[model samples]
Target chain A: MFEKKRLHPISIISHIAKQLIDTLFPLLVLVVMKARTVSLGWNIAVPTVVLLYTTLIGFFTWLRFTYQLNERELCIEQGVFLRKKRSIPFERIQGISISAGFFQRLVGVVQVRIETAGNELGKAEAILTAVTKKEAEQIARQIRKVKEGVVHDETIELINRSEQPNDIVFSLRFRDVFLLSVTSGGVFGVLAAIAAFISQLDDFISYDALYRKVQALGFVRNTLSGVVAIFVLFVVAYAISVGRHLLRYAFFTVRKQEDMIVISRGLFEKQLLTVSRKRVQGIIIKENVVQRLLGYVSVHIIHAGGSLDGGESGSVVFCPFMKKERAASVIAACLPEYHIHHEFQALPQRARVRYMLRPVYVFAIPIGMVAYVLRPWGMGLLLLLPIVSYLGYKSYQMAGWAISANQLALRSGMFRIQTIYMLKYRIQSVATSATWLQKRKQLSTLAVAVMPKMFSKVTDVDEKEAEAVYTWMQ
Target chain B: MAQLSKRISERAVSVWRIYALIRFTIFLLVYIIVCFLLMKFDGPKWVVFLLAVLFLADLFLFVLLWPRWRWQRWRYDVREQEIEIEHGVWIIKRTLIPMSRVQHVDLKQGPLLKKYKLASITIFTAATVHEIPALDEQEAEKLRHVISAFVKVDDRDV
Candidate 1:
């Protein structure tokens, strides 16, 4: 089904309009905020031109795009001016996923993405922006049938057969999302973003005047009030972070249907992604300092193709938050082949002195220069030295590695602990290195690469242990 | 120190020396341009003096010292099971890639290498690429064939 046919004409409006809104929304806000300074003619001129340009792009993009699917491969020819051709054989296809955004939902259509065992880092092989749900499902089914070497009997009402019931494997609750985001660095991230945004907003409005106005209100006067104001600010940031996390992971679910693990989440964007079980490289259970203290961890799936935009990282977050004790069972329920181990062989004692001294040596020159420049004012920054030492100590404490059967679990972190669990068969390569000092100290840094260009390393391990790992990998 | 069985061609030293010289000359040219600009603007003479000192130090450190150290450090071994590579002047890194995981092998030749009758063999596993740089052309060709032959027909989709 393809070359002569096109997606629903509404795709032009729904898909392109969403992109235009995302890109132009901030610009539009800026124009309106500065409308008084700029002439009415200029304000109207900017939006009018933007509107006309987007319309032309949308129309041409839709007019030029077409896909053709045959027994051998799926071919797509698109681009308004520069004709681009892409073909994917059925064997290379990993899976197909359907998602819907607000616009697509309004038009009762879904956006379909085709994923392959692609060499490209972070992109889907093909995307059908707007297609009927039935057609999308049929295409997915047909591709699967072809890959499985199942002969298609088109004479029968076979495509209409209901799919295997999905077994729900893992899910995230609102309470967990709230707790996860509150304790996460995300609160600080949001607060920093807001602070930076307000700082930049001076271009449109003056916050200095607003600050004086607030001072007149006596909002932040004495130390007690200042403390309370800071507290209030933190509470607001935490609230926003939780709200964002909740919306992003609302009704988050993972279900297995045959060989595919399907993940669906998001309140507005409604992302549904499928990962072929065969293509899963490994899983990493990550816990930051706060999460470790609270006994919570997040699990991420490392897939081969890495085409699915799982989250901020290439690995997809399987469960945003789970009890540290419960993580193994939760992961087992979904992917039983991997055994997540908690016990680890800690770094050698000699490594501790090296770890602790590293940060000091790195930050010494910079801190000294700053202190020299700022004198008494910057000398206060020296207080951070103790904390830096403690961080290095913590990194030494956290670093560990273990091997069981044919699987390797490597744990390393300064502030956030990540335990990468990969089977021996899945490991792409292993590299061990040591500086002259490290070699003298009998310590080596071992890096294990599971996905293309993604490496998890444990530095300052016993050279013997590193050698053992190499032997194990061999 | 652990020693790998093989070393790159001796010509690699001259190649790196030539590269370092070329790079140093560019830096010298840029410094000349900057001095001209500074003179045009009647800028500080101390600035040019400071830069000249830095450039001389750079010549000593990079153009003279680095190539020999790099050539001395680089080594590799192709075994039946895995290909091991060790390189780096200060922090020597040894990477081991099992034959089963190798995706492909490439023998690449650029203008400088061609001029010297040398080539580099790049071995790509699923995750990273390791290059044994500036080998004899025939040695690189042999390595390309050996690695390709050793690479299993079915990689575990790595």
Candidate 2:
């Protein structure tokens, strides 16, 4: 048992930094508003008052926050003015993720976030923002021992032996990191983020000057220079993606403790991710066209509730990048229960025609309307029909479901192919739908619902096969 | 596999018809007020005529035709392992909820349902919910108890 203790003193600085960031926009707006009307002294006074007030509050917040761990619960007493206290039981703690921002790294401390099952919108049950790395590890070990019902003597011994060797399952190498960025489609994300940033400044900054600069370079008239500019932009985007990946996942390592898997990674901001083996719902093997061509795949674990990515739906990635064979070996080493035989039952040949027709019908209405409106020249747009239909056909080829006794595997998607393996017990419900035309064709769409609203559907399967799967779900 | 496609109570037709009639009346009132405003603003006569025609078509379809179609389409069955529901007129959807996944069962009755001596059963799972509408009150209670029992046993096993 650990006695009540205050957070590391560096937390005061972190707290102040957080407050400054929070008030940055409002302070900027206020300064802009008062610049001409108010005196220079008054302007400076207003900002100083705001900063001093926030700093005082942050100081009190840091002073008040204290935490303790006992046999049953981890109790946190916090809140500056209101004095709120939360007691979270060891059994209720589903996961604990440790993160260290730039300031925390400089100060040699990490932030520990504890999560329970029913937490909504990514809010942790308790967050210890500043704790030493050794203390954080000790707390995690204690929680794990309690969760697994291990005796205190064994746990105390394990904690006492600081040199205990943990089995290292996998480590992301330099080549793996390079392959991840090149194959990840993260360049598009960087481009989109940069575009969004520029768009936000659209009202303040003028793009006409940049456009005129390019125009003055004679690049507009010479098509070769235009192509060169595009190449330059692509290289810039790729470089940004590589830099971002390196910052986030540098020196990534996966280690196996007695009953849990711990992943530690990051360069600028260190992150420690811990997941219990029993809580994983399934594993997903995913690869995009680029990754497939380059012979690489990524692995992610499907766990219910609480997200690691804050806002977006979270998946626990065991390997950010690996060879297809290595991914299978990692899965076998980490989640042996899920590494079962998967016999896939593919979609029927007749269903391929309907899959091909589906997109054609969807595109026909808009394309036909356009062609009808612009009688002669717009007819050229119909050439896109073949391309769309081919994509749909590819989707049909990719979509499949396999059911053995205990496990159900679904393989689907066209552009980014994903093969998900889940135990039958993890499925909440199964549904099949058919339009009147589909009924006549003896085809139906199968939808299987899993926890946290991850619904997998295989379209254009034989109605009888869908029924068989439905019956097997029992 | 046993096929159990049981329809809801026949009185549900009258209940749906009453609901549709109420909706139609409200829509008609709103339509009349809008038409008055349009005429006052010197809107085109043909636009008013088109609106009137569309309102009439809606009235004919929803008030007169849809209740019967809905009653005919809605069917549900409870098996030992799963609950099967077949619904929708145009799309024709079939949903199968595994008994092990059901978290709780709720028996619900509104003023209209009470008036018709009917109730609906709502089954909740982790991901989503399913409902069987317009069952006889006693039947709804029995179904609720049966489902809750299954959910309890499933919870014990887990």
Candidate 3:
């Protein structure tokens, strides 16, 4: 039922590097401790044993690693002394996904992932490390053909399979990518700086000393320096993000493979991700306040079983920028089943009032108490009340929910408009509740639970409307 | 097996009432011990008395409302495609789980329930938990068997 193939030779280096990175921190700690103790005998023996263990494991991994693909199954054989084999039946295989980092891209190879049903986390059932783009496509096509019994004639074909006339699918230009990179939150930049500083602690002064030095720079000098530093950080972060995005999405192309949609992109570390027509929960067309004003929207597919790694923390955005109309057309063409009407219905005024008032009352008591206790400082701090109130109101106004024939859609967030959809069958359970005030106002809050793709639950809906929808669903 | 349509046995209320009472009693005893220890350490006499009074009041309320708290009110309608559960006091919650999504169902009994020859049935969905507590052992076993058969049938159909 399953066949085996050999992994690319380059995977040996990648696997070793991965193993080294995993054990580096603990090994460093042990070395530092040995140095402080000044016991050369123990230090030498400890490091020697550690190196031997690491080398032995690395060598065994390289020796044991093997991959195979046949008509019915794909099998991966890998383990140290204890040999283990994993076989994924062709029929159960869901999709093939590819991703490559800068180093892999430099070597002109991409990592291929073969996803299967049931398992949510962990590596794809099988991975082909450092495969050429053509080879990856051939593997993906063969797997799909065996699984679905459909043969795609051309490697890349654009089909006009719609009642409406076809239009050109828009791809991100270099300028749009730059704009998105600049506007992205620079949290990754700050974290990278902190990591670098920590790693060089032995060679440099302590973080506290650095902080004191910055503080001693006086008010005007500190402010000017802070502004200059922030500006420089933003420029660097923007450039890196833009460069990465360009490298990853340079030759982006979308095409149909039978009933599935396949998107392949990237200049160096190319990726080919395919989504079955039925598996796409919904197409979310989003635009932040800035992007909305600029008439651009980002397109993302809401998949039921798979999520971007890092628990939605990383901005591994798909289609970073696109015109709203073009994005809609692409979604319609790609996934005809999930083509929802664009008309959005705002919540009732009473519901909006309840939503805005609840957040205020919840925060007001504690905030007011804190402000009163700190009144000796000044009454000016109380000015934050109006700002908080404004943000709450904006959030209430932005929150909306809509139900189409087969899809339930919810839009939320203040600065960034996030739209999510859940098909009827995928929903596991729905529960509704009403606080005393809500009950008096004839309103209820509802929460629908779905299987979490990564770590957290993906339940999104307006509280009151969700209750109504729950009742309606039942 | 006659298709079981209703909830667990009528004796469920009595069992839940006893459980609540035992829990409340334990809570009261713990509260008293903590307050007594605090007073021994010369803590605020007034605060300790107030807390003790609150605990006593809570115990009384729990005993008085035991009937309402222990009442087992559930409505289940298993159609060809889905199973719906409506239960809860004060706040009524209704959940509809499709037959396709039901992973498994189990009928379990603890030491207390074993004495009474009763069992609790749990329906496992993909994400949420639903329990039908206090069924006669035979009834529990029958429901579990029936649900398992239905789940397997639906899986094949899909």
Candidate 4:
């Protein structure tokens, strides 16, 4: 067993900040409402009391919380009054992640999260809110050593482990990072959200006044100039998106050490995740329309236990941007268990009719209503037919499945293409479904349940091929 | 390929019919309340007639026909290596959950199922859950034990 240790004193302030962050928005709204109605003294007094209460609570929380790491398990005892104690065995821990924010880095302490394999979402089994970077590394190394059954000579291994060299399997290049930010769909997503938010403001918030203000600002004069203004808005959104990606993945690097993949990244604040290799369930290679046109793709790993916080959206991004061909090499060098290929078995030609008819049937009623309402202008609805046909064609072209021995790879998408590579062991279930029409055409949809609910589906595949996948999974 | 041999209890049809009837009763209550408000507001009286016709049609289609059709389609085969479940009214779906992937199995009974002396067995994998609904109580218990043995043979978790 080890001595009980408390988090850094800095966590007292951090805990207060974390608590405030949860209510900061509502607290601000309340303060503004009070500021308009109540006296200035009361407004200041209210915030002061809230801060004092939070600080006092943070102090006691930090004081009460203590953790101890032994050779067998990690034990945590924390509570203001209840005095709850929880212990997690080393064998049960799925992985460990370490991250340091701006403030934590300044104070040389990192937040340590011990992840346990379970069905829970956004939860870490044990979180040591604040520990020195050296301590965090020692804990991680000790856990890894114990998990590997190397606790026999802990002191020497602990020292030599710090000297353990990690093979740099992959990293983002300077130019590649710029290219990634440029082609990232995140910018468009932000722009669409901003557009939606602004459009909603017309109902009550008087967007007319805002439009007039923009007119006054001389950004909009005629329709052509309005186009320029919209273009400027897009540029700003792109810059913001790029800045965010740069901050988050500037020094991104993936390294292989023992049975763990260490992914470290960030510019201002560093984050490192040590994922157990066996804990990774699958891999996904993704490409948006823009990235696909440019022949670039990103690789992400589907992991089981890590929290969604501070990590890549429930799955870790192994490669932010790389050529499709280069991604194969990286997977070969780093994770040979999964395989990726651009070529997949094509769907039968008869199935093409089904894909083409889908968009037409789905949009027919809506387009008819629009055409009816618009009358003369409604003739433009015919133009949508070609676009939808192209979509259907793209879906047919992109959706396919290929099995490489023990691994199954599925490429499928509508607008954004995603190719999921899953080992036979990672697939929870295999399904083959066919409607009457598809059955007549000897076509069935093949789908598999994978982690993170990334169910990969190859629609309108040859039924025999679907049966092959089902048998392979069995 | 061959079709799955095992079939669920025929009592499943009656169980499903009762379940559908409960839902239809709730739908009727809501529809009647809506028509009452429409009458108060002097809304189109035709909607009242239209909804009544639709309600009766739904009672015939769902409460009467759907349960029988669904029960007939429900079939499952649990072999030594895997379990194949086939169901779905229009789009026939066949799923294979390998025995090595099964995480656990459970036998459950609600008040209505208990009244009918029926139980359901749910087989859980790491990512998906499959339920064979409305089996005889003893049959469900046996099926659960069988699947539990298979799941226990494989000690790995996803």
Candidate 5:
């Protein structure tokens, strides 16, 4: 079931570059030893052997690499002397994701990622590097046809139909991008840049020379120079932030495929990603305090096995800055099962008070001890009492759980609200707990276990209205 | 098809008492070691005395609570479509697992339980775990057979 074709010879160069980076530390030591004319037999012998070993590996990699695509499966046969064959059945292929870096783009090549369902480690079944953009898309379409066949229970169609996405769900204009960049985390970047510039003054000019020069200058001149430096740093940081945001998200477009959504963007190093509709666990619409004031929201979808580099990677910003209603409508269109409710259910006031009090009581003894030990400095630590109290109150207010016919949603986090959704069938387990006080108030916490493609196995609602939920589930 | 039925004989409470006694002995040994370290490190006499008192108080509380901890209380109800278990002290917890979700069931007997003709039944599910402890051998076997039959039944009804 496998036919062999030689991989592009450029793969050898890439492989060697990777090996060189890995052996860089040992190579540096060997170079220094030879330059010093220190003839340690083992030291010279070790590096000599390593160099030969690396070169032999590169040669064998170029010889044994081959990737073939048949009608029903894609096979890759690659090894040094011992051949290793990997076959991915057409039915099991989940999605194809394409990514290109600046260097790859310059060489007219992109990295193709093939993802599959089930299992946490190495869910990206295969990765093909340095493939032409046209060839990458062709392979992606063929894999998509196979995935659709499995979902719909049909044989593959031989026709090479160009798969065009349905509609652009969300896009950010230049003005929107600029507004978002300036009002969001831009001030911190500017301050960091100013600090970095001040630290680099010795690098730019000798410390002694700069100190003497500054002493020779008048107070007014020194003040003016400082102001100019600050102004230049602010401009540089702001420009860099805005430029980076625009370059990475210039033509961001998310379109609907048959049973999946495809996100494509970037002027250079373009990336195209597909996620099955069923795999999407939830949709998070975020609006920073500034974005909220300006009536804009950013939508992100949570999907299993959709990450590009294995950890929270497949986050596609469907819309950078759009009207809340418009964003909600698009989300509804894509995920018709989830209905956006105007009024979210909040925990009861009594429950909120108990939740806030529990943390305060838990920290009171330790806080008091620290205050006694520190004396005058302890006065500063007293401020933490109110901060902890406020966070507890906010967490209580933000925590809520809701269950629909087919899904369960748990909302948490104070400043950044995260609403996690899981299908009823996907839930591996449900655990409920009640602390001593919670038992008194008849309140309990519920944790729902889910098998995400990576990281945390469980997402829970702590100290929420659990009795009512327990009754409902029962 | 023929049906099988078995009855389980109840065991004595001395078995649980012995288990609690062993646990208490271990806790006492750990407490003594910690106290010895504190005294050897030149800790304040008053502080060491207060810790000793606290340790003694905890031991007394455990002794008083031993009966409640060792109480052989468990309930298992196998209905037409689900298995329900209610257990725990101070705070009771109830779990209901649909028969369709039960992957398997096991009947285990320890040396002490084997001598007393008693066994324990653990029902495995995809999501939840439930166990019935201190059941007589006949009841344990009957429960295991019934659960296995239900586990084999088609899950479509769930």
Candidate 6:
């Protein structure tokens, strides 16, 4: 048992910095308004009073916040006037993560985040924003020991505090990060962003000026400038994507400690994420069009709870980038139970025509309306037909499902193929649905729902096969 | 499975009609109040005409037609291991909920349901919820008991 103690004194500065960031807009407005209208004496008085008020609040917040860890629970007392005390037992704690940004690293402190299953409001239950690295590591080790059924009284052998042990089960190197950046479908996103920016740019800049200028130039010059503009755009987009990948995934590492998996990464804002094996619902292997051509894959782990971005599936990247050949080895090292090599049961031959019909029907309405409204110009939009039809065919070819004694595997998608492996016990429900057209055609769609609202569906399978799956899952 | 896909109890259709009747009464009340105010203040006639058109559409669709279609489409079946429900009129939807994943079962009766001696059973899982509406009170109670017992067994096995 440890006595109650306040966080490191450096936390006061961090608290003030956090408050400044939170109230930046109002503070900026105050300064601007004061400079424009207030007299010199009033200006000095107002700024001084605001600074004093914020500093007092930060100091009191630091003085009031205290935390303690015992054999069974971690208790925290916080809030100055409100006086909130929270106690979280070891059994209820789902995960403990640590983060240290630039300032925290400079001050030799780490931010500890505790997550519990009972977080109904979808936020960290407790966050100790400033603690020594040694204290953070000790807390993590103790939690892991408790989860592994080791008695707390036992004198555990301590390792070197300065170095994280050489126990990484999976890791991404510099080359892997580069490969992921190049092939992770950044081209489409960058193109979309560029398109949106160009549309909005019209509101800011008069493009008619440039158009008239271009028209005045010779034909060859205008064509040459157009090519140069496109080339520059491509270069800029690729550089930005690759740079983002490098910063976010620098020094990415995953380690297995008993029943827990700990992942830590990042160059600027370091993120440490812990996931309990018991809570992991499934694993998904994804490969975009470019990644597939380059023989690269990324692995994601799905679990119950809101994700880091408060989205569905709570999926985190287990492996950012790996070669096709290395993917099996990585899976074996991290999750041995998930079978990487298996023959999947594909959809029947009749499903091809049905699959081709789907995209045509989906694209028809827009095409029809555009042609009806815009006449000849909309007929040019019919060019999208070939692309959508090809996508539909590819989606049909990729859609498949297979089952084993303990696991079920489903593969779907057109441009980005996703193959998910889920333990049978994790499935909450399985269903088979068919629209009136499909009912007549004797084809159905099978949907299997897992926790955290991940619904895996394989479309255009034989009705009999869908029924068999429904009964088998039960 | 074949037998379970049939429509719910015959009484549920009457229950739906009564539910629609109450809604229609509320709609009528609001319409009369608005119409009275509009005429008193000499509002535009076109606005009142548009409101009347919308109200007529609502009355024909929700009060007159939808209840019968909904009754015909709604179906549910309770199996040993899972519950299956098929619902919706234009685009029918089917859902299956496994018994092992059921966290709890609830039987609820509002004032109308109580007057009619009917209940609705709601089954809850960690991430989602499903309900089978307008069953006989005794049947709803028995289904709740059975599902809870299955949930208890599942917990014990784990």
| Candidate number achieving the greatest DockQ relative to the actual structure | 4
What are the per-model DockQ values? 0.70, 0.58, 0.34, 0.71, 0.12, 0.44
Work out the TM-score per prediction: 0.87, 0.78, 0.70, 0.84, 0.62, 0.76
i-RMS for every candidate (Å) is 2.0, 2.6, 6.1, 1.6, 7.8, 3.1
lDDT of 5 by residue, A1-474 (tens): 335666555666666767977787447645554544565775667777877888789878878777888877888888887888998887776656667655566676777777765333445787776677666666666666766644312111211121343465655666776776665543445577666655644243456865677689854576578679779877876676777667767667666656766666676656666566776655656555455567666777666554643435544455666777786588777778775543445666667776566677877889988887656556577777777788678777766777777676666654444455555554434445554565676565565544342111112233444544544443
* lDDT on C-alpha atoms for all candidate structures: 0.79, 0.77, 0.61, 0.80, 0.61, 0.75
Each candidate: RMSD: 4.5, 5.9, 7.2, 4.9, 9.5, 6.4
Model 2: lDDT to the true structure:
0.77
lDDT by residue for model 1 (A327-389), tens: 888778778889977789999999998889888888888887877765555687787677778
Model 4 residue A300 lDDT score: 88
fnat, candidate 5? 0.05
lDDT of 4 by residue, B17-77 (tens): 9999999999999998999999999999999999999999999999999999999899999
- What TM-score does prediction 3 earn? 0.70
- Model 1 chain A: weakest 10-residue lDDT segment is A151-160
Worst 10 residues of 5 chain A by lDDT: A153-162
Tens-place lDDT per residue, model 3, B28-96, is: 788888888887998878887788788777666665554455455455656556677666655655566
Q: Residue A112 error for model 5, in Å?
A: 2.7
lDDT of 5 at B51: 66
lDDT of 5 at A417: 46
Give the TM-score of chain A, superposed on the true chain A, for all candidates in the order listed: 0.82, 0.73, 0.69, 0.77, 0.64, 0.73
For model 6, residues B20-74, the per-residue Cα lDDT tens digits are 8898889889988998899999988788889889989888888778888888888
lDDT of 2 by residue, B27-88 (tens): 88988998998889998888889989998898888888888898898988887777888888
Of 3 and 4, which scores higher on lDDT?
4
